[model samples]
Target: MPVTDVTTDPEALTMTLVAEFAAPPERVWQAFTHPRELARFWGPPGWPATFTEFDLSVGGRVAYYMTSPKGERAPGAWEFLAIEQPHRFEVLDSFTDERGDPVEGLPSMRTTYEFTAVDGGTRMTNVTYFASNEALEQIVAMGAVEGSTMAMNQLDLVLEGLREYAQGKGTQTELLSDTHVRITRLIEGPRELVWRAHTDPELMKKWMLGPDGWRMSICEVDPTAGGQYRFEWEPVGDTEGEAFGFDGETVLVDPPRRMVTTEHMTGTDYPSTMNDLSLVEEHGVTLVTVLIEYPDRDTRDAVLATGMTEGMEASFARLEREVMG
Candidate 1:
């Protein structure tokens, strides 16, 4: 187990858990900063977590929910209090209502995380301070310790990069949580071309077509934050489906590296999805990563069941062959 020991103190009304990972502090810290990486180990076994929003700065808050096997949800929020690079951070952690407001009846805790470099690995000292002994006992009685142990143990797999979709391969999808999926693809071209292929309407229209019988009829892109992008595709001939399009607004953008958008169907009652796209170049190849968040588990399942991954693979293959080349 990554978690070596857990201790509780009634006098101080605090609980502390010590965990060691065979990873550096910087790598371990990245797991917390990246929402997709954090979601993999944030919930206990049998309950998967979904983080809809992540604000990494001090005084910023994050909203997340863990869904039980029976479809029950436990919402939570975290307000960052302090951050010291890759060494330490603190947060006010609380159980919240579905709207992400802290519940009046639940006890919130002041949690501190300290990461130290020890023996070429990192030791994380996690401490949660409660208001009173009763609050401490209340949380312990809820099996918080055991659940946390399980959750932390799962972090070893994440640190090992065991869950990365496909390495040195085409488009591949990995389920990060009940409502989140990550797709990655390595393009054998420069990073600039990859970015242009996504943002430039002329380039997007060439390779964004899903299958052989479909053609992109409309490709309007606005890459600035708060701007909108609309893409539509139609069956060329002898193709099987009606025309479809997607419209989305840019939530954030860092040219050549990252972009975020909230996407909705051009004409449908379907729930909207948040997509975080990032590009990283190593050596001569560029890797494109997309983390997608669905509204709920049902919506996630329905979307994935529609052959979304395969369609994405087809588009990415076209991008490599036709656009990036």
Candidate 2:
């Protein structure tokens, strides 16, 4: 089992568990932050988890349920209180009803997860703080320790499969759910430079053009929260294509790390979508990841059916050649 030690301090009203993994901190962090990865082991062997909503931002909440072999569900929710990137995060965890509201009479706990680099791998310290001694005892009596161990023990297989999942793949698309899709591309460039290429309008105009026959007619970028951005594209000489543009305002911005924005096609009544973009650098290459949340399954399907993935791949290839190259 990954969890090697479990300790309870009644006086402190805290239960701490330490787990070690044979992987780096980033990979372990990803396992917890990404709903798809977390679902693989979030529940014990017999039960599987399905995250209905996963928002990895401060003040955002995550709602999920674990289904038993007999089709019973145990719902849970987390209110994110703090986040410090690849090191630590804190959340207010509670048992909830089917609607994701905290259940009355059930004990709620404050949980913190910390990751540290160790000799050969990463060590994760998970601590849960109860409101009182009675609360701590109540959870302990409910097989909290055993359940946690079983859930964490299943993380090894998930961790082991991550490297093989994305190592050599170029720009790849993953259908995270009916309304959510994740697209990732590992580009041959540093994180800061890649961020610049994305936020700088001049640089964006050069390589953001998808195919060879198109040109960016207008480009306006503001990579800050509440700032608006617009991009218009038209066919170049003799090319057959109509003009199109997109408009959106930045919702959240964490420079060189992450950004969340609302996006919609300009002048269209189509519902807007939220897109979360993140950049992580490893081994001299930066992985650009975008998680898009569509309004509904129909809209998601319609967008993906528009050769979106191919166009993104072409633009990313252009980014590598014309900009980063």
Q: Mark the 10 consecutive residues where model 2 has the least summed lDDT.
A: 160-169
Q: Candidate 2's error at 81, in angstroms?
A: 21
Once fitted onto the true fold, the runs of candidate 2 whose alpha carbons sit more than 4 angstroms away are 1-106, 109-167
Residue pairs in candidate 1 whose N, alpha carbon or C atoms collide under 3 angstroms = none
The top-ranked prediction according to TM-score is 1
Give the Å error, residue 307, model 1.
0.2
Task: For residues 1-325, write the lDDT of model 2, one tens digit per residue.
Answer: 5889999999899999999999999999999999988987898644568899999999999999986533468999999999998999999999999878899988989999999999888999999999999999889998898778878976886787534435567789877567778788888889998999989998998899877899999999889878999999999889998999999998777679767788999999999998877776765778787878898999999999998998999999999898898
Tens-digit lDDT track of model 1 for 1-325 = 6899999999999999999999999999999789988987898754668899899999999999986533468999999999998999999999999887889978999999999999969999999999999999999999999888878976876786532423556677777677778787877788889999989999998898877899999889899988999989999778899999999898877789767788899889888998878676755777777878889999998988998888988999999899877
Top model by lDDT, which number? 2
Which regions in candidate 1 have their CA more than 4 angstroms from the true location?
1-165
lDDT of 1: 0.85
